[model samples]
Target: MRELPYDRLKAYEGQPVATAGAGKDLVNEPMIRHWCEAMGDANPAYRGPDAIAPPTMLQAWTMGGLSGHTDRSGAYDELFGLLDGAGYTSVVATDCEQEYPRPLRPGDRITFDAVIESVSERKTTKLGTGHFITTRMEVRADGEPAGTHRFRILKYAPAARMTKAPERTAAAGETEAAEETEAAERSKAPGQPEARRPRPVINRDNAGFWAGVETHRLLIQVCGGCGTPRFPWLPGCRGCGSPEWHTVEATGAGTVYSYVVMHHPPFPAFDPPYAVALIELAEGVRMVSNVIGVPYDKVRIGMPVQLEFLRVDGEWELPVFRAGGGVAG
Candidate 1:
C-alpha cells in the first residue's frame, strides 16, 4: 500500500472550508421538539412560551441535510480527494465540542462559517490506520455570534474484515483425545471468566435511573413544576428549569421508532450484529436499548416491543425490548 502523504495533507490546515453558509430554516419549535423526542430529553425549558433550543442542538440548526450546501469550498473536497486517493476511503466522526454564548430562540436566523483547523499525522487505531481532521465553525444567530462548534472525524481505510474458521468433523478417537485435553486444560485454569461489559457512568443526575434498573423497574422523571415526564433522568426540568421532581414507573409498552444493527468491531462480552433500537414509549418519550426475541434484520420501525429485564452477567442487568413472547432462532 502507498503511504499517506501527511505533509501534503497538513498543508490545507487553516484554510476556509465553508463560508457564509446559511441554514435552510430559522430556529423553530418543531425541529426542537423532534430533537428532544429523539433524545428522550423533556427538559421543560425547551417547551412553552419562553423556550430555547437545547445547547447540544447547536449544530442541528446548521446542517445542510440531504441536498447539502452550495457554499462549501473546493478546498474541503480536495482534502478529501487526497485521502481517498491514498486508500483512506472510510470516515467516521470521532468527537465534537460546542460552546454557547447565547441561547438560540425560535425565529433566529442561523448562519455560519468553518475553517479547516488542523490535521493529525497518520496513526493506527483499533478501527484502522487513519488521520484525524478537525474543523471549527463560528455560528451566528441573526448575524451575531451565538456559539462555536469544533468537530473532528477520522478518515481511514477500513480494517481487514475477520472471518470465522471452517469447522471440521473430528474422528471418534480424535474426539476422545480432544475431550481429555479439554478436561486437563479446564483443570489447569478453573473458571476463566469473560471480560465484563462496559459499565455506565452514574452521576447525581441519572443515578436514580440506574438504581431503578437494579430492581427491574424502568423509571422516568416527572417535573414537579410543569407536570412533564422525561426519560434518561435529568436533574431539572428542561422546560421550566425546576429542580424538584419525582419518579414514575414506565408502562413497559413501546414501539421501535428507529433502529440500527451493529455489525462491526465486535467487542468482548457482546455479540455482533445485534439490534439497538430507539423505542418510543406509550408515555411519549424515547430511549435507546437493545431489541431481543427477534433477529436484528427483523426489527423494523413501528414493531411492537415489550420491556424486559436481561441479566447480561452476574453483576449487571439491563432493560431491553423483546419483539414478542417467543425467542428468535
Candidate 2:
C-alpha cells in the first residue's frame, strides 16, 4: 500500500485561524436530550423542549455547532503552506487542556478565535525518530469566556532518503535532472495564501485523538453510558445512559469488513490509490481506519488488521489500522 505522506504541524504560524460564523443550530429537543443523556447529565435544566446545550457538547462544535462563524478557509490555507515546507510527513495531535467558564445554552451566540501558542524545538527519539510540538488555543463566547482550550500537536519528519541526485549542473546542462529531484525533496513554506489549497478545521474533540496517534496508542471513548466503545472522543455515548465514561486501552485487533481505495482524496496528506477501510474488531464493533501492510495494488478484502499510531500533525499521533497482525516480519 502507498505509505502515508508527511504531515505539517505548524501550518498556521503566520496567519489567523479565522473562526467566523453564526454558530450551530440547536433546534430539536430530542437532539439536545440525546446529547445531554449521552453525558449522563440529565438535569431538568437541560431537559425541556427548548433545553440547554450540555457542558461537554461544545468540544465537538467545530465539526457542526454554532456561534457566529461558518468557516476556516484561511486557516486551512495556512496549514497547507506550513505542511508543504515542513515536508509531506505524518502529523498528529497528542494532548489537550480545556477550561470552561459559562455553560453553553441552546441560544447562545458563540464566537471563537484560534492561535498557535508556541512551537518548540524538534526532538529525535531513541528509535531514530524526529518530532516536535505546536500548541494552539481556542476560546469561545467572547464576553463571558465560555470555553478555552490548548492542544499540543505532534508531528514527525520521516527518515531522509540517502538517494543522491544526478551529476553537477551548469547553465550548460552538465547535470542529469538531479537538481530537479533535489528540489522536489525540499519542503516549501508558503509565503502567500494563493500558494496552497484549503481544507476544514478538524475540530478539537477528535483533534486530541489525532495527535494521540503519533504516541502509538489507540485512544477511544469508553462510554460513560452503556460501557460501549466509541471513537472520535466525545463526552458521552449515544448507545447507553452514562456520561461519566472515560478512555481505556485498546489492543487494536480487528478484521476488515469493508474498504475503499481512493484515487482522489480531497486531503493533500493522502496519496492516490489509497485505501480507507472499515475494520470490525473481535468485539463486534467496526471502525473507520486505513489499512496498511500491503501494496495499494495488493490490498485484499477481509485482511486481518491491527492498530498503528502514526504521527500526523504536531503532537497528534493517529491510530490508523495496519493490515499485518504483529510487530515483526
Candidate 3:
C-alpha cells in the first residue's frame, strides 16, 4: 500500500464511526443477481425459484449495508469516512474473502461484529507512505455464526487523516467538528500502535490445540459423540451439535481443497504472490495455511503437503503446511 502523509493519517482520528441503520429490502438485489448470472452460477438455489442469496452476496450487501453490527450508518461508507477523518485519504478495498456456514435469504435481519485484525506501517515507497490494515467481521443471525469477512484496506494519500487542528475550516469549527471524534477511535487512533487488533483469544474451545503446537505437534479435535473433526478448537462437532470431543495428532499429509494466489500486498505481514491454501488433512479435517517451499504456479488441487510451524506475533505457534514435492522459501 502507498502511505499517506501523517497529516492524512491524522485527518480522521477521533471522528465518530457508525454502521447503524435498518435498510430497505436489499436494494442491491439486481446487482447481486447480475453478478451470479455473470459467474454462470445458475443453480436454482440462487435463481428464480429458489432465488436464495448467493453466498458472496453478503460481501456486496453488508459491505456497507444493514447487516454488520456497527454504530455507523453505512458499513462500507462509514469505514471510509472514519479512515478519511484519520487522514488516510487514499483508501482502497484491497480484498474481501468470505466463508459461508449457511445461506442468507430474503427477509433475514443481518448483524455482525467487526474487529480490527491487524495494522502495520509499511516501508516508504516512491509513490507515497503506506499502511496495511486488516479487519475481521463475524456475521450472525440470532446468535449462530453465518459467515466471516476478512477485509484488507490500503491507504495512499498526500495528507494524513488526523491532526491537532483537523483541517482548520474556520466557521467556528473544522472537519473534526463535522465528524464525530468518537468514530475515528472506533478502529484505531491516528498513529496508534498496531497491537489493538482483536485476535484469536485462547479459551476452553482451543486450549489443547495450541498446547500441541508448543510441543511441535499439530492436534485436531475429534468429536467422540458424533465422530467429526474441527479447528480453531471448537467445543463440539459443528455437524451433530455434540460437545464431547478428543484430540488427534495430524499425520501432516494432505491435499489441497481450494486456494488462491495472492498478488497484492494487502497485509504487511504476508508477502505478495504467495499461495494460500485450504488443505484437507489425513484426518479428513481441513485447515487454512500458506503453502511453503512451493512456487505459486505448482500449487494445484489435490497437491500433497506436510506440516510446518511459523512463529506469528503471539506466543502461540501457527501451523503452516508444505507441499511434498517442492521445498519452500
- The best candidate in terms of TM-score: 1
RMSD of each: 8.0, 13.9, 16.2
99-121: candidate 2 lDDT, tens digit per residue: 77777665566666666555554
Per-residue error (Å), model 3, residue 177: 54
Model 1 misplacement above 4 A = 1-5, 28-53, 165-229, 245-273, 279-285, 297-318, 322-329
Sorting all predicted structures by TM-score, with the top scorer first, yields: 1, 3, 2
* lDDT by candidate, in order shown: 0.79, 0.54, 0.59
Per-model clash counts, in order, read: 8, 55, 49
lDDT of 1 by residue, 16-79 (tens): 9898999999999999999999776767789899999999999999998999888999998999
Which is better, 1 or 2, measured by TM-score? 1
TM-score of 1: 0.67
Instruction: Return the lDDT, model 3, position 307.
Output: 81
What's the alpha carbon RMSD for model 3?
A: 16.2
The TM-score values for the models, in the order shown, are: 0.67, 0.41, 0.48
Two-way TM-score contest, 2 vs 3, winner? 3
